[model samples]
Target: MPTEPYRIAYYTDEQGNKPFREWLQGLRDQIAAVRIRARLTRVKAGNFGPVRNVGEGVVELKIDHGPGYRVYYAIDAGTIILLLCGGHKRTQQRDVEIAQRFWKNHQEQRK
Candidate 1:
């Protein structure tokens, strides 16, 4: 029997806006954006994307080429991938900080 694919979700801010979507829209590299979308879709379709731990319970989805893009996410309940934020190598530090905050908020809301 085939197992169900993990559900993927984006973090929404207090104002009801999905920050991931906003960040995606603001991406200057269309190719990188396309690749990111493809990776996300593949993950939702049961394929695991390339990622690494970035502390604070956040995982960095590595995107090769063109400034080295990345999507910061958190795995929850072994069934959900929560995308907290996105950024490239230059912004990794700041992005990770934001991702941690988002993940913390998400956990709090679940309680």
Candidate 2:
């Protein structure tokens, strides 16, 4: 179990939009959705999968999907697991950008 048993949360942009949650809802693959939910559940239970440091305090929770799916996140103050973005391997850069944007907004909100 994670030392902090984090609570999962969707990243909201400055405009108060939850793009990540929208993306999840748009997923048409039922099987993939179930698998994704399982993976995210593990994350909430503190079982973050093969974590890869993506820099700037962000990390990727590698979920083994089609060509590999990823959940970009950062543990805020060690208690909240901010779900930054989700995408497949091909959208790695774009997903990173999304995470960065949300992270920047999150920091601003904290101030």
Candidate 3:
């Protein structure tokens, strides 16, 4: 257990749409949704179950449900986990690209 709780934030694009929340809303599998939320909660508490660094400050939360799902994020400001995007193996590259794009744009905006 972590002494300090991490804050989770969804990445918003120029139009102010939260892609992560949209992805969650689009999930059709109720069980998967429950499990995914549970995992995200654990992450916020610093559990970080099955996470791996993919590159470019992007880390992936690996979920084994179905054909394997992934949630890409970045740890910004030391304690904020910015949820970038979500997808499966087939869309891994595209998802990473989107995440990196959002991360880059965010960094630029901060400066």
Candidate 4:
């Protein structure tokens, strides 16, 4: 177990856009948004069930809710999950690509 629970933060771009939050609101159903947020809450509490690394330091979070929902994020500073973006299984390929770019830009800005 981790010594302390992780903190959840949405990765903001140079233009101050939060992809994850935008994705959440774009969902058709409010319930779906709630479900996704619940999962994020678990992540904040250090309860990530199982995650898959998807390159460029991004990890995939799977939600069995509907249409095989998925979230892309990266662990930073030992205790922060930086949410990059999200998409379902169908859009996964594209989602990963976007996340990679976002992660790279984020790292560059931090430097």
In order of appearance, the predictions have TM-scores of 0.89, 0.89, 0.93, 0.92
> Across residues 2-111, which tens digit of lDDT does each residue of candidate 3 receive?
36579999999889999888998899987887888899988998999778888889998988897688899999999999998898888988988888888888888789
Q: What is the full ranking by lDDT, best candidate first?
A: 4, 3, 1, 2
| Per-residue lDDT of candidate 2, residues 1-111 (tens digit) | 425477888888868888778777888877777888888888888777689988777888776767787878888988798888888899998888878778888988999
lDDT of 4 by residue, 1-108 (tens): 555488888899988999998998899967768888998888888789878999979999998877878899998888889999999999999999999899888889
Residue clash pairs of candidate 3 = none
Worst 10 residues of 2 by lDDT: 1-10
TM-score (C-alpha, index-matched) for candidate 1: 0.89
Query: For each candidate, what is the lDDT?
Result: 0.87, 0.82, 0.88, 0.88
Best by lDDT: 4
